[model samples]
Target chain A: MSQTVKKTFRCHPEPDECKGCGRCVSACPKKLLKLGSALNIMGVPYAEYSGEGCVGCGACFYTCPEPGAITIYEITPEA
Target chain B: MAEVVKFGRPKGFFETFERRPGSIKKNMSYCPGCGHGVLHKLIAEAMADFGIQDKTTFISPVGCSVFAYYYFDCFGLQVPHGRSAAAATGLTRANPDSIVIGYQGDGDLAAIGFNAFMQAANRGENYCVFFVNNAIYGMTGGQMAPTSLLGQKTATSPYGRNALTEGYPLKISEMVSQLESPVYVERVALTTPANIMKARKAVRKAIQINMEKKGFAFVEVLSGCPVNLKMKPADMDKFIDENMTKYFPLGVYKDVTAEREPVVRPVPTFEKADVEKALYRELPGGDQEHESCDSEIFNRELRIKIGGFGGQGVLSLGLIMAAMGKYRNLNVSWLPSYGPEMRGGTANCAVIVNKGPIGSPIVDSNCDLLVVLNRPSLDKYLPELGENGVLMYDSSTIKEVPAVKPGQKAIALNTGDIAEEFGNLKCANAVMLGAIGAMLTKHYLTPADAAKFQETAEAAIAECFAGKDKIVKMNIEACKLGFDKMQAAL
Candidate 1:
């Protein structure tokens, strides 16, 4: 079989105001985001992207209410 | 006649065009003419159309539409009534990359779960909360709900609900729109073709906004509960628009931004020692000592009940006790039944603390200790006390003595009178808590544990009283009195 194409989407959180309320994880159509082990400036859990099968639909970025808390980017084959 | 012709499948058919890989292929469990079915269908179609079905996480609530998991192809959670918002908050926060939809009914949204719902909106938690408003409580046999329209009658309201006595129906869409954090708030009805089209547009726009990761978005659909409304399916549109729409108006309430951001939260990996040092703290006792106490207490179970006047701290006491149980490393659960009983003039709560996981949060009958703050509570639940159970009550107001079953121990103390003497009438609950702690010493909880519980109780009470110090002090003393009395009785 041909090499399976895989894409990775990630969310970056702002350390100051992420309250750790997990709305983005539930809002993603790809089910790729989750609360990461890292703590923000306020010491709350922030969203983390771990799954490799991201469609880049921007659902997580759109559904996240915290500005600059969630950053979505796609990882292509070369990366 | 023109010749009939069929076109062949287009190129890249599997890759470019297909039904959403995540949507389930099954009929919904909603009733005929129920707006939930239509709304679910619309959402599924939208997800499929957008090719993001595999990424959605649907949060379902208790109501006529509780079985939403069976219909959605994505991961689904059937949450408790009014808790879908909180659950969605957890699920979405845990999986910010998934499409989360919090679905609930009017009773679930407006009455029981309003606080969580409002908090989520105020914080602008990213997700779409679709509230289905069908004037009456359809799943609970057409009871009058917070959103039940004035002048409408239901099981509880024999006559039409009077605005003067029952209060006007809550406009949830309007209420949610008033919050600053929410980016989009709209009310749409599924009554007629025109209204359906409007609702479809609103749904699409809300979903699109959610996809954009802008802010909190909500859509309230004024749906028809034909069976509960005593109307036929054919007349649902007329009934909803004429009666329901008049009470719950339809329109877009708020939309903050046009542009969207990419949603992503950063991940931090931590060492085991760092995690332990960060979460664990030194309390009154040393860390090792406390750890051993935790293990020992975690192996024991305790059930305590609190009953008193409506204004008394019955529910608060139960919560504090539950908190103490948690502090002791035991599994804890607290439940209260106070609406009609308290309104009819009484208050009560059941708290279960166990070493292992609890089977049910609700108690049908029998408890380890019955703490009665008033005569009615004593009379009502006194018989349900388990054999060898201890009964504690305030001696001040309870003048008439009712005969008890043999071998049941009843201790009467002037808790309310003592609380009044202590200068805080609300301390009656604290007194009961102290008595419970003293009586259940065999369960391995200490006076310090009880005091810690009291502190939590005081904090909650302060919030309720808007930070009143005198009330907190009085309740604290009442707790002391109960502890002292329980010692004397034991």
Candidate 2:
């Protein structure tokens, strides 16, 4: 077996770009995505990341219809 | 911490949508949860992955996807409503190596452009079609479409779709699979992640077939219209899975890609000599020597308006004058306006002649010369004459000669009585042409050119009535008689 390593994945939501239809909320397996109460410049509440526990399955990236709305990334800790 | 991009915007799309014409260039104009955006993302990703972005041509239909060109970085053509398939055929044939894609909705493909789509599929054009069926018109309000489910309540079908009236939903995939030309046909949905994966694969396959030039490929995407259907995104997905899939029955209806070879259409030739030979079998004649008119009066543009009742040959008179200008190597344009009736209707034509390039053919006002064969035409067009313009009227038909402006000259000719004396009342237009010839020689043309005006008029008549020797001879004689009488009057 290989050594255990800390895993980190994150979902970055562009507030101004998201139309906030809540599609990504349902698409997230870890339930780490939600719509914020505060509206963006488009007058609709945009989706936000929970700031933790993002497995980065990319479900929310595909589910979010708007281009450039949800971008997923992987983070590596400094050695 | 080090960041590694997992999933971001595809490189197939422009870094910023500069063509969208709005402040938000990062987002598309589709409504929230619109299926077009999802499909666009899938296609854009596939384009970037396949490296066909440079050769791919997306034909956008006239529905919500009309602005599709504003998003994709590939070559895009926004065709008229329901004409994407037709345009795709031409694009694919003209450039056989191009990867052509047609994006259409239910109304655009099934309702309006169904035949065009089917004919292209039948001919096996090398392209891919992504048909988005949302059961209702998304752009033009939630009107029921050909693919709308039975008992579905829409804006047009308020009482719900009735089987007896609205007809059943069209099974486009089933119908397209029945054709022999299409190499691949599948129906997929975008409700769940698994289903969306299937749709994504289907999209890639369709585009791959197109890239390989393996004949026509069609994928009918059963999508949702959340806003139009007045449902939330989750409820819309449930509605599509529970209600739509039962009717649509998602699966591959046909796949003959393994048996078919890559399609190869003949490339079109564009050689100048070949094109000329194909368009015209034989050249008419060597260029005729054209004499240039050098009169000082001909230096400026001459706008002439001719008006008369139908059967009075008003348009023919304008044609003769324009022909006179053409034979002398001058710029000329003729615009004819008339009612539907061939007789007893108001007919008028505007003829413009200039030594230089002419601007507009419309002579609504400020005409340099006004010719009227009837009283009503005289009354209607007299006010349009310019300050120093000339007015020519047939006095035989127009008994009351209206007073002219101070700088204007009115030459009233009894051409109607002259034609009657010439034994043919139908020759009155020819007599009027002769009167115009006399007027031009007196005022506009130089003496040297004036002597050739009669020859020009005769040649114009012969060219107008090329094969009719009898009519041409009669008109020429009548023109001579009218010219002598008008010269005497002048």
Candidate 3:
């Protein structure tokens, strides 16, 4: 028998690196990304995460054109 | 607790793009949602994962992706428009262990550099070529490219590309797969998530083949040009899937990678001696640069002009004189000017000998010695003689004797008559050379140099006709006869 483990997958989008093409918003399977209304340093709307429903499929990471615009993280909880 | 980065920038890319200009080097200069950025990311990932980043070299084409060197961590080379494939072939041949990748656009590869790319492919160069087909030319303000669809409208094709005029779109993957040399050929699109996954796989597979040293792998990527096509990011994908894919299908056209062996070409030699041998440089005499001259005439700058008909050997006579200067340990320059005809036309040459360095090979004016073989040459070049210049003429060809200036001396020799009497009429230039030797001994050269003039003339004749024993002997006899005749006349 295996014990249940809790894990957290985070989608981190760098606002300064993002060109706000909205590709990640469409690529997300959970529909948790949005083109933010507030402008970033680039003076354009940047992609934002809903901070809840990231499954870490890496669709957003692959869709974003900029090299370091988006990154996915996997965090495992301790027993 | 454990934390890991599931997806991030590949290590193949620089930690910071130092090659890129300006402060904000984190992002590429490509437009937002550009297909080149996506492809760059895929290639960077493949380069890192395959562990060929250090050994890999990327040839950037002349398009929007010309700045690929700014992003790649490994070696990067920028080639002229559409010449990346040719440059990649050289890089691969020079360094067989290194991986070469040629990045090109539709305008560059298909339109401008099609022949170079095709020849490299046919030769089975050990390199992977990534051909990006974005329907239209994206770099030069959306011009119509060879891969552009018939109905597609571009800057040059304003009225929507006509089937009668623009022709059908080129299926590069299909064309490349037809060639037997290419080991792998695939057409992948950057449209849907599934399609992008396929493209990612194709990119990795091509680079893998390069790592294995497979011969000629080609991947035609159906990319998007959102800004140039005036479409949004999401719509661009739909356009490529629906419209472009109809013309250029997305699939693997050929995959003989499993059956093919690694290519092994002969390594090129870079040794200095080997290179000099390959260039056909004479290896016997090392350096003949001498500082001092034994002759007084060689101590100052001496400009000699020899003019005649083409068949009179005027140029060869100038060469012999220049060779004499070379033997005397002086700097010499020979400049030959001739008409288009090989024979019967005018020919002239200037031989300049100097103790110091020669400023120019041209002897347009202020000639110290003028040797004319024909009447026309004598009449044309007489005025160019400087003060106290020696004017020598073949009296057999010229009827009238030219009047000499206050200090100048005019010497006449029956060069043609002497050449015929000696052996062959073609040796008239040799007779003239002997006469020139006799005149220098009497007037210009010192006693010690005068004694060596005959030996120098014989040596110059031997050098000019090297390996031709009969011609060397006959010309030396002809030179001695003309020398004896000139000494008696003087």
Candidate 4:
């Protein structure tokens, strides 16, 4: 039952549109999103993704209220 | 895991509502990451899930929820502040097919609209009521709401909410749950992701109850006021989690869905014939509408003020004019001052007869005619009359008739004397109405006997005293006497 599943995702945190509400970081079930040290234009700490273990749940996208805050893309393994 | 897929915006939202020209998607009126946006999305999704989108009627009143009309893709009504619940009852009762969703704020539902909310809930209205409790009055600035937390500082409560002075905060969800009619009642929050999920469930269940036709359902969403609370967007949830939740506990207050039978809404078809049948209390065509005697006067747009003491039927006179306007099928409005001096105090109202829809009902300044029953009212209101305005005074009470400018008419009627002659001093205002009728129709003798104008006026007056035979006859006699005097003077 030990299978190494290599799945990746891209969490696009649109910097300009994000209100830095951190809803994305809190909603990510995979714990891949973290608040980066850098600040967006609004001077709030923007969320950054680790690009690992996204699981493609879209929880971050679902919970975000700010438009264009997060977009997730699923990665497929090469056959 | 399933592939992560996302749509641009909810299909239930109007594209224009979600965005403006050259703007990003989700151009909501609410602030960034406000609770309203999340709630709006939840409601829209519920409408879609239940297949009630086509039949949904979103009712939003004043407060932050006022802009909900622009958000919901379905039919929306922006009603008077705090009237969402009241209007929801009417809409659901009449249509029966539509799913009425009433969205209200704490200031609206708990404060000014509390009566309507209670009445609607007590009657087990067939609708879903969403009450957004942000603690503070968000739309009108961070003012104290009925649900504002104790020791919470707001614009009005600079020293924080003093429990002794402002009284204990109202537990409205618990209070509303005490009512015996509602089938479901729940309190939820929307600050965190887990809370948002719970709120989504609560929102869905509220709508689900309506879709089941299981009677009234209320969902109180403990939302945040980031801008008003002056908290950062992300920290508002933390603030609510720490401060607001301590006072307003989130839970299901009542759920009797399994015990109650589904509501059977009686849909009465509204047609001209149906209204006529109900109005006449008989078959349609049994009665005839009042035919116009003087089309010019009847059709003219006129603003008339009737002023006197409270008990003197100053308000009633304006109402009679409004009734006449209805008979003529002209749009009309009667706005009463409802001043403090009720019985002995000065009371007045403005009655506007218009060809089209009325704008503001307030008539503090301009008036085409001033009919004053007492000297005090006459003196106070005469100077404010518009140019070329007609002045009609009660000669029985007013000793001196004020001089009017050229091109203006002054009619003095001994209304008290005429009403006393008819064996009722209470009918003085009725007499004034008759004089006004005579002035307009140009007929004064036995105006009640005339089959056209005078009889029409009498019929309109009789409506005011529908059940009381004594008052109706006395008012008719008083009107005839006043009409004769005015006709003779002319």
lDDT of 1 at B213: 71
Q: Evaluate model 1: give its lDDT.
A: 0.68
Per-residue lDDT tens digits for candidate 2, residues B309-352, read 99888998899888877777677889999999999999999999
Residues B240-271, candidate 3: write the lDDT tens digits: 98989888988999999999999888988889
Sort all candidates by DockQ, best to worst: 3, 2, 4, 1
What digit string (tens of lDDT, one per residue) describes model 4 on residues B1-490? 4544342346567755542434444456667667887788778767876777889999878987676767678998989988888789889988887899998898999999999999999999999898889889998889999988888899999999998899977888898899999989999988767888888898888898888889999999988778898987568888888888898899999999899898896668789888755643421221345434345444556788988988999998888878766665566788999677657888999998786667877766667889999988888888768777788889999988687778677888888888888788988998887787667656322333244546656666778778888877777788788877877776
Q: Tell me which residue pairs clash in candidate 2.
A: none
lDDT of 1 at B103: 88
Model 4: residue B319 alpha-carbon error in angstroms: 16
Candidate 3 positional error at B63, Å? 2.8
In model 3, what lDDT does residue B69 have? 95
Off-target runs (Cα >4 Å) in candidate 4 are A1-16, A35-46, A56-59, A71-79, B1-8, B15-22, B283-490
Tell the DockQ for candidate 1. 0.01
Best by TM-score, which number?
3
Residue-level lDDT of model 3, residues A1-79, one tens digit each, is 1366656799899999999888888888889999989898778899999988788888888878899899898977655
Error of 2 at B417 (Å): 2.8
lDDT of 3 at B367: 92
Error of 4 at A35 (Å): 4.1
lDDT against the true structure, each candidate: 0.68, 0.89, 0.88, 0.78
